[model samples]
Target chain A: MAEERQQGHKWTMIVDLDKCTGCQACVVACHAENNVPSPSEDEIIRGRANHWIRIERYWEGEYPNVKARFLPVFCQQCGNAPCEPVCPVYASYHSVEENLNVQVYNRCVGTRYCGNNCPYRVRIFNFWAPHFDPPLEQQLNPDVTVRGPGVMEKCTFCIQRIRRAREQANVEGRPLEDGEVQPACVQSCPTDALIFGDKWDENSRVAKMIPHERQFKLLEHLGTEPAVYYLKGGETHVGE
Target chain B: MRRLASLSLRQRLILGVAVVGAGALLVALLAIVIAQTSAADEQPLAFSHKTHAQNGIQCQFCHTGVAKGPVAGIPSVEKCMGCHTYIATDSPEIQKLQGYWERQEPIPWKRVNIQPSYVYFNHSSHVAAGVSCGSCHGAVAEMTVAKPVVEMNMGFCLDCHAEQENKDALWDCTVCHR
Candidate 1:
């Protein structure tokens, strides 16, 4: 289902589930780079935890030969996002240039409509004030905002890094080259399970990888065209 | 409902008046805070931009980082001594500069323009876009003690950003808020 992409860049990500070790380097990298709030151990179960990208673990089969399947779920940057139209405040909108779904922090009034309408359940509400303990507070990334309570936030695909890379490319009087802008997750992947690039460019890796037999979009039947593409693992049922 | 019923009309009136009065007081105090945040905070040495600018000294001469980075960095004491060594040795300001240089200390220059903690401003990007210092700071060459002549508010920034000629693709909230 290849279609013509929008001008400038159509950003996309490809995650090979087969190669994922689930070491969660991407998780730690995202936390460090994006200033995800650190809720205390007790607050975590109370629905006050914050994670822009979360690894969903689904256990398969009984305990004898059980296996945990990990799915790293974040905002899909959907082409027809359910979250967008539901936002009465117009805080959640799409960025055409990068094919990104961005949240306007100041404009968001914490209505939680966008969160409710999201099918992927990627949107996490700030149930309480975001915090970082003593020394961790000093480690907050200056490039990313420590979003206040009463705002619903999700993964922006590291918009700060994208803007910076674009600025540099513009200053140099050249188009952004392939593999130029790596999101925090893509950069930290030890197994190179994740790849990010402008799908508009024919030569880009993501564009080339899109049509592979193993490639699939999460909830494709729902018709929400996600920027993220995942590859199925080669494993089969234990008795099969 | 029961709690309100327990109070007489006079008591309610007094409470209403107090709420409005407190609200107004709070608003007034916020205005003062905002005013002083951008107020031409008195620098330690009372450096005059008017005199230096009139003498054909560029804004970049002292604020070297303006064109290349996030901050328009303040001039080091050594930079002042670089010219004050020969130019104005007898002047009081020059003597002050000399003293800081001898002490090997940096001059803690008060900022004329202030950005809130939430705002992420890039000086290099603005400079590259051909924006003049006066566009935001007002006429730097004309000011004696440089204060924030322009109100650096979100609306102020968005107006410039959404302009037809200056319309950048980066009107995204994360562009500035982060």
Candidate 2:
């Protein structure tokens, strides 16, 4: 049944590194939208912070001539995901319908094998039981699950929103329009750095952006074939 | 008879007990299946589906969210008061609804059908796909109080979904599970 899907939406995201201010708006939006429990100070200190998406800061040049480069990294949604095969349980697998990597929380057994195998280090393990204080509990999105402890979770590109848009389009008896589906990161991007759309649509912003000279992917040499593309910064090839 | 006679009294007694225990377990299992398929959970007010259907009240009139979202939401006491304010005001069931409405409280309606949180079933998509409510929900129009005539396990979903034209897309894990 998995082999049957040959044509469908190839949801893609184009991140222009030049436009990004590294404000962490996407990170905050992801937590709010997905009901991700905030990590403690100790967890952060232990490098166990549960961030679905994070800005990776790098320093270039020496002394006074140093430049700070920010690259927002998350699940690349690899076509040939390393994490997929390593899973004893089929928790991590490619969704042929949406052309995205899916992590089924219910199927996950906390093996952490997927986490270990993931080249992007995007997969996060739930170390403790999830908690939400009073008013914050009221704001939890009914569309997304509040995952329990002992499950693996990563960026889903806000699939709940994708499902919503798809269902709406299906009900209307029409195809999904370009830029109709937006992940939380793309939606909250203040600088419009993150552009998301179905790459299969010839006129989509992502499709148009694909041909640009500045376009590249993170760790392209490894051949993960990620759905995400990165447009290099103007001054220096920081993303490259 | 020869084999039975060869066994000691203690061995025979143990074997007989085991047989009876297994029989009891099988009966218990059958009883559970029967209960799940036919038992109508007692609701706060005996809201009769047959009564409403006969009166030409559409199922979607109360289950407003069925065609719009994931949940087929329970009707609020205010919705009941909208009609019971004039009609059936004296009926005990309607009076129970009136009491809840008078106190500005919601009627605690026990869910007749339930799906786990992991299984992300969307009602709008199913409704849009030309599926009748009775397909999965059974014959609610003919029922007095709605009972789960169908067990909505994974097999129940896959059986119907497999027959669809877009079965390939429907078979994806992320379609129902996030």
Best prediction by DockQ: 2
Residue B37's C-alpha lDDT in candidate 2?
48
Tens-place lDDT digits, model 1, residues A163-236: 77877676556888999999999999998989999888889999888787787899988988998998887474
Which segments of model 1 are wrong by more than 4 Å? A61-64, A236-240, B1-38, B102-104, B163-178
DockQ of 1: 0.42
For model 2, what is the error of residue B75's alpha carbon versus the real structure, in angstroms, after optimal superposition?
2.2
lDDT for every model? 0.82, 0.88
lDDT of 1 by residue, B1-178 (tens): 8998899999999999999999999999999998777555667787788999999999898889877666788877778878888997888878888888898888877667767666788887788888898899888788778777778998998988888462546665656754
Interface RMSD of 1: 2.5
Deviation in Å, model 1, residue B74 alpha carbon: 2.5
Per-model root-mean-square deviation over C-alphas: 4.3, 5.6
Question: Could you give the interface RMSD of candidate 2 in angstroms?
Answer: 1.0
Predicted structure 1: clash tally: 0
